[model samples]
Target: MQKDKRYDQLLDRIENDRDELVELCLKLGNTPSYHAKERNVGDLVVEWFKASGIAASLQFITDESVNAVATVPGSGDGTSLILNAHMDTGPEPGPDATEADKKIDTAWTEGELIFGRGVINDKAQLCAFMIAARAIKRAGIRLRGDLTITAVAFETGAPSIDKDQGVNYPGEGFGTKWVVDRGVTADYALVGETSGFGIVRAECGAVWLKVRVKGREVYTPRLERGSSIQENPNAFAKAAHAILALEEWAVQYQKKEKLEFEGGAIVPKAQIMNVRGNDEISQASPFCDIYMDIRLVPGRKPEAVKKDVERVVRGLGFDYEISAFQYSRGHIAQNAGPLIAAIEEAHRYVFETEPPLPPSAEVSMWRDLNVFNEVGIPSICYGPPRQRDPYSGAGNRAMKISDLVAATKVYALTALLVCGVSDR
Candidate 1:
């Protein structure tokens, strides 16, 4: 079918409301929701949804986190559509912030880009969904299927390890899993993650592993030098060997394992993020800890990855205890589905060009879409245009203002098409 008048009308509406969309994006980006702490941002979403004439509610995931949910009912004869994104920005700079890092909390427009924490991480998606819902309402289009928007919490960082904070070692997909388990589900879910508007159907799974290497404590003088090293088992020395071995393993793994897709392939990766041993200067440390982050392509299980780590460590003849500290599975959705088709159609209509092929896996990262996919909901990530910060140390997170407008059009159009308009 050729492009329809409804698609053009929606695109025009999104373009005309560009200023409001930018304002909403700034509002969401400026509101800081650190980790499990998202009360203010969550409340803001709820308030906005209700004010826009959508049904809104807050579902508590924990004392510290809540999932803000909004819905527009359809005719009940078609598939329900879910527009999802996390409310939490990535790991906070903690309570202590240098003036520069603190500036990241404020959203500002510089030229054609909007700089802020959540703009690309997901505040942009949150606001885009809100605007899309509002456009559907403004156009007076009644969908045959229900339209639901879930602005979830903690999608940016790993699960809480702090028990006193009421979080007990949660990992990725924390909020989406909570909502799914709590009976908030849909036939199709469009995850608003930063993918430069690329449709993402697959992603790599990941796990955090902690390895402890044990050795006999010995005096410094007894530590062997050169060829004598065979007789001495210094924990620090053993850790050094283990770190090098792990690094080499990571290089080989990346070279050997790859999952190819339309645009690119995902390579499984392993890296030693941290290493620690006793601080005593006079003696060889008896134990050392190694922190490992392993990324696996979809179809590879975390258990298997754990086994691979154990195999490498055991091969080195080191007495060790390895544990999967935390883990999240990856997902692969159908290459073609109603949600994908609707999004592709929206992209073509909005950009007047063919959409890029869907990404193989969101490279190395995971999203709430993984959670929804696990629970049998067909989900994919499609959001505003963004690029990774070249300086990971200095905060320069940003996205194009034009990209936001285009994405809002795609999102609004996707919801309208997937939900199916009804005469009622």
Candidate 2:
């Protein structure tokens, strides 16, 4: 974990600019970047890069949102690195906000914790990467390999889960996939998720399935008058039966599909997220849609998970069709990969000890680390451990300012080591 003087200087710079970093986190959290609507925060990210003299631009994925991409070019002799962080956050406090939600949703530093949605979930990491970039620039250190940062969009929500919502809304990985499709790749990628400063070498991927039940549509009055309930065939009620069957299947499937790896482990899960039937309350609905969220362990295929669901639903004697609406295969990287090694070195230097690695159950949360690892560019997640909302039991919902600074140091040092420093 011995770092060059340049790397040490950069860490010092990050420490000196702690107030500016906090401001960036607050600014991003205050700006509402809900789901795919990330224009405000994305644009601000791009502006920060430009103002810092870094090469910056917008990778437009949709009419409304763009990925904020910036780079510190290198001399082309060493390995390149990518620092990826999502621009979006989870749901915000609404009109009926609890006192805790109101307090934590707004980013601020009181003692050690920085209470906010964006800072806790991801935007804090985004700011950390930005500070790392600034520290490098301030030290006037040139890298032999390139370093790129992306503030991506559409991470908070899934893509195209509901047909009624239209296919135009391409869901999760929208931003990161766009970056890859546009050929913005590197030798490795570092995802700044809430990994608790530990290296996350594996994470579960998700498969979203939509099941539709079909039957005859009839008026309730006719069924009440002479027809039997079976003749009227309420698809909604039949879907209810399928849900109960799915619950039973979930218990068995999760146990059967459980997997453990050296980097982490996962208990593949199936949960019914939504059920939709009649548009009008008075009408007898002939169709019902069941939406399921299935988390897949690494090496598990979406087709297999779909088949499992089909088996349970078909066994219910209901006329139904099931399809995987969305699937993201989980990703796993070796603990000895360059990405993990650099992160470990930096983490040890920052904390003066080896970082803790989470167990399988603890590291099962999904992030874009899978995106890079799936493409053969080794990647891992390393960042601050998320704080829980004491009142709401919300996980990955808060952050400590000190932890944020520590992560910033790790990010900067890792980039220096992996990218290699040069005199230009």
Candidate 3:
């Protein structure tokens, strides 16, 4: 209704302004901050917001690389609405090593797609939101709620997952929780995660596991006599047994997810395995550690899975212990909330369809969304989406000309409606 009209109105503007958005993404992506470099990517996002007439600022969390922040302010609803993206990307951009540091590095571009480190992971999302903020300011529509955009760091690290430990919450860590503590209260939080035009209602939680296998060493002459090492304490053999057992348990866990959940597809179609990594054996040093990431289903708890993991290692009858453990609380905010409905209405207005629905199955990797969700925020993740264009497997990183135009229409319409523009 209201959303459709808004999209119809904003479609042209979204198309007109995409190149600017892509340029912003490239310049900033080149910043070493893509990983955890000294420079802060948040700095660039903040600059874009303020430069475009939005009230943007940085809230310092610390003096170190982890202590940075970025925000863009909006008008309306007295209550603030959040548009957030983590400032960090895993395996951050490597040294540019050359000057062609252009936003769409031709050297990095492949066919229709733009290429570069950190180009897709998140810099794209940040750019999309920045462009949206700029468009709203240029158009003069007032919002029902104030729009606040935040870009921060260290989302790829472990401490970043604890929502209860939000920034400056009198705790010692960085995460979405920290963003909340630093005054990012909003009616809803939108994670710009490149999920095409849909929302991610359920975020799969993660549990980190490290299994250690120690073996006894014996000389070949005495291998037969070593009680623990009839075959020199066959650590490899023990590891294989443990891995096989864990695989069996993981399968059962996955099956449980299929029967227990709805919506999204359980992809890669199974749990990830780091069954046995970094193994070593010598006459002097004999031990192997199997490190793995366990992405639990929305309703599943790592604690519940912990016992299963323990049972498997124990069932092997080999000595083992759970070395380190951490888990993310799963989350799903009713997509029908006034906030989401309005946003989706805006999306439908732009896309001319119901817009992609949220995924039902949890994603396999961990993300900052866990922090907001764990602490009870109706958090969901989304991002501009484009498969490899017809020309190739990639396209624009920030605003796929095709997807960006569509997303920009959605963003503009959603912003206008959510911000409370009285008429189209």
Which stretch of 10 consecutive residues in model 3 shows the poorest summed lDDT? 164-173
lDDT of 1: 0.79
**The candidate that achieves the highest lDDT relative to the unseen native structure:** 2
Query: For residues 306-401, could you state the per-residue lDDT of candidate 2 as single tens digits?
Result: 887898877777688988777787877743377777888888888889888764554675688788877878888888887765634464476888
Model 1 clash pairs? 159-170, 202-361
If ranked by lDDT, best first, what sequence of candidates would result?
Answer: 2, 1, 3
- TM match of model 3 to true structure: 0.80
lDDT of 3 by residue, 297-331 (tens): 66676777777778878776676667544555555
Overall lDDT per candidate, in order of appearance: 0.79, 0.80, 0.58
**Preferred candidate (lDDT higher): 1 or 2:** 2
Instruction: Answer with 1 or 3, whichever has the higher lDDT.
Output: 1
